[model samples]
Target: MFNKILVGIDRSLISKKVFEVALSFATATGANLMLVQVLSDREEDYPQLPAYSYYPMWDDQTVRIYQQQWEEYKKQGIEILNNLAQQATEAGIATEFTQMSGSPERSICQIAYTWNADLIIVGNRGLTGIKEMVLGSVSNYVTHHAPCSVLIVRDTELLPPQSTSE
Candidate 1:
């Protein structure tokens, strides 16, 4: 029986479905839920890539722009996490939230392990083949690396549509 459920969420279309599944499990087991969202800076994350490589030349303006964009992303992530936490609270589930900054897979797994989570609920974006290879799969990474059990909710919409003619 799960006593501590950690749910990783983002601005993805499948986030709502993922939350619903995690909420149901938490409610059934009376488990404490922890909602986590990662706010990563693309420039900082891939520092190996020179900033001037993406532009004609490196300039203060470019740095400022990148900093502003990163701040916006962080703010949006916090708002989403806050909303999710409020929803969970209203549903009578004991909940807390953390906004982390780093690789999604690493942050999620680290939090789960440090928090002593009994389970981790996450959504699979269903990337495959070339895309999966290029971008890597967060759910797959978590499944392999997490210290606790992981439940990856596949979005129903990701499936091929059924034919009406049938």
Candidate 2:
């Protein structure tokens, strides 16, 4: 009975699983799916300066580099979201893709709540304990903070490999 479903995707191996599971569920329920990707603002990464610096002239070069990096990140993030939207369309599901600049978990949760999603699907670290902890799993955060129900699709749990012995 999910009317609005939100799936959080990132450039990771687990994202494919998230996409599949979210798409299937949305299809089954005849729900509208929203794919959200976050691109952090580059300016946030650098320290803020209270006063303008002109003597050393280091600020201009630093700002230029940051701008370039941010542009690249934004471009890549948009391409990814566009592809995801296309894939969902190919699956005959209603979809919308968005690229926002903010914390990943915060952006996802905000969108889910704003859209009033019945369920939010995300990917786990594919049965890896150490990696999950070290990377600070986004799915874990979304599951805990989302306003609605959350489904975590672990890559390893999705489809087990066929027996080689056969």
Candidate 3:
């Protein structure tokens, strides 16, 4: 039985599924859950311009707009963590969460280590070969670097209907 479980979350289509899996485990094991979301700058949909130096090359108006959007992005991340943590708490599970900005791979592992988690539950986008090399996989990194056990949840929708779910 894991005493503490760390979960890495993002704004992926599989996020809800990943949360469901982690929540079930926490409920069953009575484990304290640490949910984390890393606000990656390399968003596939929304592009976050560099936030340093006030984007000196750009005009003040553009810099302000980007800064505001970035702030909103961070806020959304915190909201996601808060919502998940609230769900876990409602289930009587001791829960905590953090929203960080940086490399998702490293951030998840760093939190897992510092929180002394017994298990890490993360989602796999199943990127492979060239795509994996270019995009880098967070689950892959976390599985190899986590301080304790790692549970990777693949997107079940990507699997055959007859296959095991979650």
Candidate 2 local lDDT, residue 52 = 58
Instruction: Give one digit per residue, the lDDT tens place, for model 2 in 1-166.
Output: 8999999877777888788888899889888889988764322333333355455765777777657876777788789888988988888889998887668878899999988999999876554467556656677789889999999887764456868873
Greater TM-score among 2 and 3 belongs to 3
Clashes of each: 0, 0, 0
Give per-residue lDDT, candidate 1, residue 61.
70
Model 3 ranges with Cα > 4 A deviation: 50-56, 159-166
Cα lDDT tens digits, model 3, 65-92, are: 8889888878888888898888889999
Higher-scoring candidate on lDDT, 1 or 2: 1
Model 2 is weakest, by summed lDDT over 10 consecutive residues, at: 41-50
Q: Please list all clashing residue pairs in model 1, or write none if there are none.
A: none
User: lDDT score, residue 75, model 2?
Assistant: 84
Cα lDDT, model 2, residue 143: 83
User: Candidate 1's error at 91, in angstroms?
Assistant: 1.3
Pairs with steric clashes in candidate 3:
none
Q: Rate the local accuracy (lDDT) of all candidates.
A: 0.85, 0.79, 0.85
